[model samples]
Target: MTHNLQNDLLVRAAFSRPTERPPVWMMRQAGRFMKEYWDIKNRYSFLEMCKTPEIAADVTMLPVDLLGIDAAILFSDILVTAEAMGGQLSFEQGVGPQFANPVRSRSDAEALQTDVVHKLQYVAEAIKVVKHRLQGSIPLIGFAGAPFTVLSYLVEGGSSKDFKRTKLLLHNEPELAHLILQKIADVTVDYLNMQISAGVDALQLFDSWALALAWDDYEAFAHRYNAYIFSKIDRGGVPVISFCKGSSVFAPLMATAKPDVVSVDWNADLRHVKDGLPEGIAVQGNLDPFVLYADKKVIKAKILQLFERMRGTDGFIFNLGHGIMPDIPFDNVRYAIDIVKEFRY
Candidate 1:
């Protein structure tokens, strides 16, 4: 594990340096595919793994040992923030995260607790554990759900193709929504600051549903809070990467959010993102996740095309536009990593 920290693939990629090889890692790379993760899941339910630092740290490193990616995102879910917030949350295998007690009113929102740092201290401790074990060999990334995204889950009470209730609440009851968003945003900023203090080298903010909002609504609702989270981080040296799903619309806001690195999702055009983004910030992805299922030859060809498209760019990190699905072939996943590693610039 004794490797050059300064030259670490993830570190170089964050700085937009032409790495010795293009740094490669996957979203959800530390997840179910790994036997260690499955073993942990079998031993403990979802919440237990998150709360148990030793177990979470163990899960976080499995992908690091297996795929040997440039970095490790702390093993946890974004919804964990909501659960810590006094929102009652539980997961159903196929259904995803669900909130039993949601905030529909300003009073309900106010009644819920904020400043969950003390509760989420486990996440910070897990990072500490992973860092101690990695011995500074690999960068460990800290992440949190962006405020609006978190608030969306809380208000909608779970996942939704459309956040009509959330949007209606935002529109019909502006003060209540504002109060909720404001509190969540404040917590998010504090939480991320706390994570950085916990020893994470880089950070990512996930706005998984930002695209569903209208353009102006996004500016008023989501963008500012995401900006606030970044503002509290150590920008002087540390790296900050923002990964908002449905990135085409949000690409413009990436400039304002002030992430040192901005990740592009499959729905966005790489060229357009490159064109509109602010200078000095690195770009992280755009490959469709389903590409992992394409035949190996076709997958390799696309990877070569990605390299050519991304070649000579000072600040580019090759990654799937989203996390790899569980059904993907390990061989294809390995092949994709090889292609990313061969991208000299």
Candidate 2:
């Protein structure tokens, strides 16, 4: 059903080029909402599904077929990178991602490799399969956890509200920690490069837990390392968007890495963010995911409100501040997208 290969919404919406309605893709756009995903997932454990290129590719295209989003994100867990590294990984119900062997010293850092493309062939294959099936309908985005964030999983081993173990690793073992970050950054760049090579049209580095740190800690442990990865591309040609979900303090500064854009979570004010950032770089998101809980009128009003803030901004990509939560009524997601498509801006 998908026809032309060259023209796609994400490529244009990401830059807010004037030819179309603003582009819209949710953060976890290829997630739980679809029955097909659930049906496939019901047949296998999450990790198994991820390792199966056929399954992963099918799920990646679910949002494209169901929600009509502008782009498709490869369907895989962010923590998969940790598993690809020297660490062991598993996902527990309600508990989130867990790692068995966390990086603690320089020795631990030395254990990782930048050859994840070779190591994680399934992920690459998944992208290839998804791209072929997409028939040029939309761009596919490939992503991994940012070094600091994936390392947070390595240090903490799983979901942590405070990220205490990660901070301790940074605070108590600063120099060794830098080595770990450097290693993770190296591998992340490789992993993302693999995705790009596999035909990903764009990439997003998700550091969803960054909000847990204060500015100084974020600067020391996070911002610089991420910059290092984004800086190294041959001509730095790929369109990369960095989204540090919690670090509202450093969200604006994230653009310094020269990513094509930066995505903000719901915590920050779009007006303040839009003004704080200089032009040329595109901006995506910062809308509260829970706002979808509101009924039609409120959703419409707030959606328009967001459009107003983004008015005149040439490269804004509309997205949720975070991901759509579990059991989010189908209508809410559709209404939000309709608002985005209907907006004159």
Candidate 3:
């Protein structure tokens, strides 16, 4: 399962090894902005693109080939785990993802399929396909939604701004919340291990909604399950990245969860976060994604500014604070990557 990669900078940086420069990759690097992605998107539904190994692998490789990023993340959605847990998932035109049957009651929580690895075989197959296509060019990253974030979607049924229903359930039925999180955590551990066995070089746990909780709430609901999931996964030396947006306040708490890397959002200062986190945990991200909208000169300067802040810091991976927007010009992304590649330590 070893990949003889030419560019192991991302892998080395993830493991906190010294590198010539910070290896660059974006969170949603493979989607929307590229014409090739739309070419395929036009032909298939979102689920079809994710389920089809060939298409998924092709999409995953697009960023590496087109943008020259140092890593390839599997082109899949976090809700796929929800789907595997026997929830019905669909993507609408204006709306992103909707769950037909959400986990609202204790019965709903118990109904979630505990045996998830077999059902998610397509993801592993897609990873294998992506690995074959990558030809050891760079490391492939596998990821899943953190248990709490997955629980939020499962409870709220879709994307939520305030997560009112989710928090209500957490407050009203705390035991039910933990029960569902435990179920999801069990599945997450099995699911991530499967991805690793399929040959991915690194993994990330995306707790996109962790910011919704207060400190005590986050510690009880989010951090507890995240820490358990991280504990159960056997990384086998591959770095695990824990990312949560709007999470500056929880950086110190998150560091204790022990992900090999902590990906910060745009608002958090990279140096400040780096100093707070324990030694040996690498830092990734902090660049504003909107900065890509600027002209090439501005983009280059902004990239340099981030690098300047991160200068002499080991275990740094250059990435946007969050996913790239759909309407962003493709060339701007290309130019940004070029800037990161050209910059020296």
Candidate 4:
């Protein structure tokens, strides 16, 4: 499954293999902070950018060319899988994603289409374009929303602070919740396999909202399905990363899913979490995204501090604990990457 990549630091680190230094990249590396991203974003709606291969490739390449990041994630949204499963999806400028037909009942859950791979052909095509353009310079990551996270969106109909509707479904009717979760899991397995077949070098499962659940609920609703996906996909030696907003607390639970890498949040000490994981499991992130908004000296010091803590550790990747905020100064983002690239073990 190896490709002739000029910069294989990311892939190497993902496997918990020793490297000269930890490879660096940011979550949301190709998004709104860059004026170049806005130029393309202005030309098309967000979904349009995702659906169009050329435009998606254009966005996906920005970080690689501008910041010299070690990896490039495909330009797409997690909810696209839900949309393919019969959820009517849309995005308002600032309101984020909304689902017109939220699934609330057994009939609504049954209506979601599990045969979604062909419907998401645009994503696979975008991956092909991105791969051709990369020419094996760096790895391109393909991803899907973990089943519980997608189910929350479908049940809540959009973003929610309390996830009231979603939790109610879990409590009042556990059977329906599992029904919907299984459907999303089915689509996720097929969707991720489709990405693998399209030539992505690695895969990530984003359980972005996992923080919203308690231990028992998380284990029953989120962790099991995530493990199911890891078990079923034909990864073909392509490393998989399991990321969640609550990984600082859930790192142990997340590791049980058997991802090569577990991407954690800023709340925990990165080195401590790494030390607690099983042997050969790599770690990515825990830096506060706001560090990029600090002065150059502050940013440099913070980056150095994390690296120093992880000084002797193997299988570390430098990244923000979460996605970069849209308004973060682009110059500061570039400076942070420069600092990481210049550092060594």
lDDT of each prediction vs. the true structure? 0.81, 0.78, 0.90, 0.93
Sort the predicted structures by TM-score, highest score first: 4, 3, 1, 2
lDDT tens readout by residue for model 4, 1-345: 766789989999999989888898898999999999998888799999999999999999999899999899999999999999999999989999999999988999999999878999999999999999999999999999999999999999999998999999998999999999999999999999999999999898999999999999999999999999999999777999999999998999999999999998999999999999999999999789998899999999999999999998889999899999999999999999999999989
Which scores higher on TM-score, 2 or 4?
A: 4
Answer with 1 or 3, whichever has the higher TM-score. 3
Best by TM-score: 4
Off by over 4 Å in 4: none
TM-scores, one per candidate: 0.95, 0.93, 0.98, 0.99
Q: List the residue pairs that clash in candidate 3.
A: none
Error of 1 at 328 (Å): 1.9
Highest-lDDT candidate: 4
For residue 13, give model 1's deviation from the true position in Å: 2.3
Q: What is candidate 1's lDDT per residue for 96-125, written digit by digit as tens? A: 889998888767888877868799899989
Give a tens-digit lDDT track for model 3, residues 1-345. 455689999888988899999999998998888899999999999999999999998899888888889999999999899899998999986798999998888888888989978989999999999988888888999999998899989988999999999999989999999999999899999999999999999999999989889999999999998899899988886789999985677888988998989999999888888878888889999789999998888888888888888888899999888999998999999999888888888
**Tens-digit per-residue lDDT, 174-239, candidate 2:** 887888788778878788877877788888889888888888888888889888888874323457
Error in Å for residue 333 of model 3: 0.4
Give model 1's clash tally. Answer: 0
Off by over 4 Å in 2: 1-7, 234-237
**Per-candidate RMSD, Å:** 2.2, 2.5, 1.0, 0.7
